[model samples]
Target: MPAAAHDLRTPLTVVLGQAELLERRLARDPSAPVDPAGTSASRARRDGCETS
Candidate 1:
């Protein structure tokens, strides 16, 4: 099911990219309150809500 795989790929990529960016930002500014896991986008993802 290439179509199903592709559908999953985009969102997974988005989540992974966001995580990497957050990781870099935290590395540079450890005191920042921008927690990736606490973000609205991440919350919706964890709750199985549509991000779009």
Candidate 2:
């Protein structure tokens, strides 16, 4: 139905937008250093997973 399609499309569009943003962030700057383990977002994800 049209309503169901609309419901699914909105979230999919948001997810695609966020993925694009993340891809841009991760593309990185050549002059900056990259640390895989030290980001606060990674720390939060690790902590959240451990608690669950």
Best TM-score goes to which candidate? 1
Q: What ranges in model 1 sit over 4 Å off?
A: 32-52
Q: What is the lDDT of residue 38 in candidate 2?
A: 48
Which lDDT tens digits does candidate 2 get at residues 1-52?
9888777767756655565566457657565566667444445445542221
Clash totals for all candidate models: 0, 0
* Residue pair clashes in candidate 2: none
After TM-score superposition, the amount by which residue 43's alpha carbon in candidate 2 deviates from its true location, in angstroms, is 26
Q: Estimate each model's TM-score.
A: 0.56, 0.52
Q: Supply candidate 2's per-residue lDDT for 16.
A: 55
lDDT of 1 by residue, 6-45 (tens): 7987887688668657766666886777654685445656
| Candidate 1, lDDT over the whole model | 0.67
> How does each model score on lDDT?
0.67, 0.56
Candidate 1's TM-score? 0.56
The CA lDDT at 31 in model 2 is 58
